[model samples]
Target: MSIEKFIQDGVTGWMSAHGEHSDIVMSTRIRLARNLTGYRFPIAFTEDDAMAVDRAASGVLLDTNQPNYSYMKMSEIPSLERLVLIEKHLISPHLANPERHGAVLLSEDETVSVMVNEEDHIRIQCIYPGLQLEDAYKKADEVDNLLESELPYAFDESFGYMTSCPSNTGTGMRASVMMHLPALTITKQIERIIPAISRLGIVVRGSYGEGSDAPGNVYQVSNQTTLGKTEQEILVDLGNITSRLIAHERQSRELLIAKSRLALENRLFRSLGTIAYARLLPNGEAARCLSDVRLGIDLGIIQDVDMSILNELMIFMQPGFLQQYAGTELSQEERDVFRAKLFRERLNIANAPASLEEDREE
Candidate 1:
């Protein structure tokens, strides 16, 4: 799909479902890392080798008669368009990295996508909204099996799947949940809670995944160790811990309301006022504020705004997405102004009562 259609539809990937506890548990993702039987890893592949892998992947996708499963050359796409895909989690950071000769085969439903010649020969992923690890894995496995019949994968009898990284050698699966834990973050409990969770072999990463900061108090929690454990065992462990974190976050939200309702309301309303009326908005500031507004919606503090609108705003406000919409490169100042205008229009905060603004200031 074209970038404009992708954005206009707003019904792609993990963004589609409103799952259980969706207010807190944003989405779940399962990724499988695989390599071709004879080909070297993407990093070591010559130009010819990369093209060969790409062609082979395209052929396999052509053979699979699944309706609406389309393929595209990622390198041929414009830069901003790739960023839009990244923002939507339709493609990974590695796949979006510049000058990479790779292609992606994705279903029209946006639930499953496979990147050819990324970090591995093939990187397959499946995404579903909220906490659904078992379901996500099942879907990914089915796709992987279908692809296996078309192409042979590199494997070792004792080690299982062979991957570029030692950790992913066996199983080669990563199960992650995208979580919005504003309550825990605001309460400063995340300082302690995150570490304890890390100790349990779970890796906490940012919204865009590895090596990124949490922009909106949003975190991707996934299993750190995948080699020895069976895929089912890994899923259960992650599901249990994620469930606990969800419980803790809910408890923190209740405590915030019971102990300091006025303070919490004031914070939420003030954030709303700034996002709706601010003349200049930085990316980071907007993300943090949007997190507050999202929590407000969940807690019944804000009623007019739809959750889908806020969710779309979360990605739309990112710098690259902003530039793409602007149809040109933007300086930081220009982006700030563009972001503010977009937020004000989408949120319709301009028509809000003047008295609410006064109260927000108070």
Candidate 2:
């Protein structure tokens, strides 16, 4: 499958709404970083060295006889197209960097993506929808095993898997789940939960991971220390903590309803109205409003709109996607206008429950 065809398919696999706690838990991801036996780390590699690593990794992945696999060189793809891949979470920001000599192999459904010559020689990533860390890990491990069979991996008996970063030298695995935590954030409980989770060897990052900001109240929670623990152990610890976090978020939502149902309903209805009728929508504003609308749907307040549309909007509203759909580079103002138009058309405003005024009277 060509990358263009993949883009045209829209949100699929991990980005779709499925799995446990789909309302709160957005997606789960497993990433394994590894270096080739004789090659230098990506940071120190010359263009030739990167190309060699890319060739080796891509060769193994493409030869797997999987009709669904598609491979693309980073240098050959357009800048906007690369950003689209990142937006879809099919590739990481680092892999999209033009200065990096890398290639990516992706499964047709986009559940698995192998990045070659990014921070390491190979990055095997598997993502699935909602609270499926173990499943994601299992898929990633299968890809890792395939690569290890054909390409030699750097390993240390003492340290386990060798990696470019010292922190990832052990299992070389990072398991994370993206969660929607608007209730916690609005109640100011997220501030406290983040610190507490960090103390427990679990780290919370933004939606796009590490350095990105968490728009739409979406955060990624993952294991912080991979050095000493076994892969199963890491999954268990993170899973337990995530379950607790989900419970807390649900409790917080209930608290809001019990404390001030009218106010909460008003806020959510207003959010839905804004997105459904607004003439222009900034990215940040759109994210915040969609978060509220999603909360309303989860709480059984908004019954008509499908959760899948919101999920697709989350990716389609991004800059890269807007431009890709437009078939041209868009100015900021053009994007805002286009975003609003897209939301208005996609959202089912005609059947949305009458303004909360009727319920307020009761």
Highest TM-score against the true fold, candidate? 2
Give the lDDT of residue 301 in candidate 2. 94
Quote model 1's TM-score.
Answer: 0.93
User: Tens-digit lDDT track for model 1 on 107-137?
Assistant: 7788888988889988999999878888899
- Worst lDDT run of 10 residues, candidate 1, spans 352-361
- Candidate 2, residue 90: Cα displacement in angstroms equals 0.8
Roughly what TM-score does model 2 have, to 2 decimal places? 0.95
- Work out the TM-score per prediction: 0.93, 0.95
Candidate 1: misplaced stretches above 4 Å?
1-4, 7-11, 350-362
Deviation of model 1 at 140, angstroms: 0.9
lDDT by candidate, in order shown: 0.84, 0.88
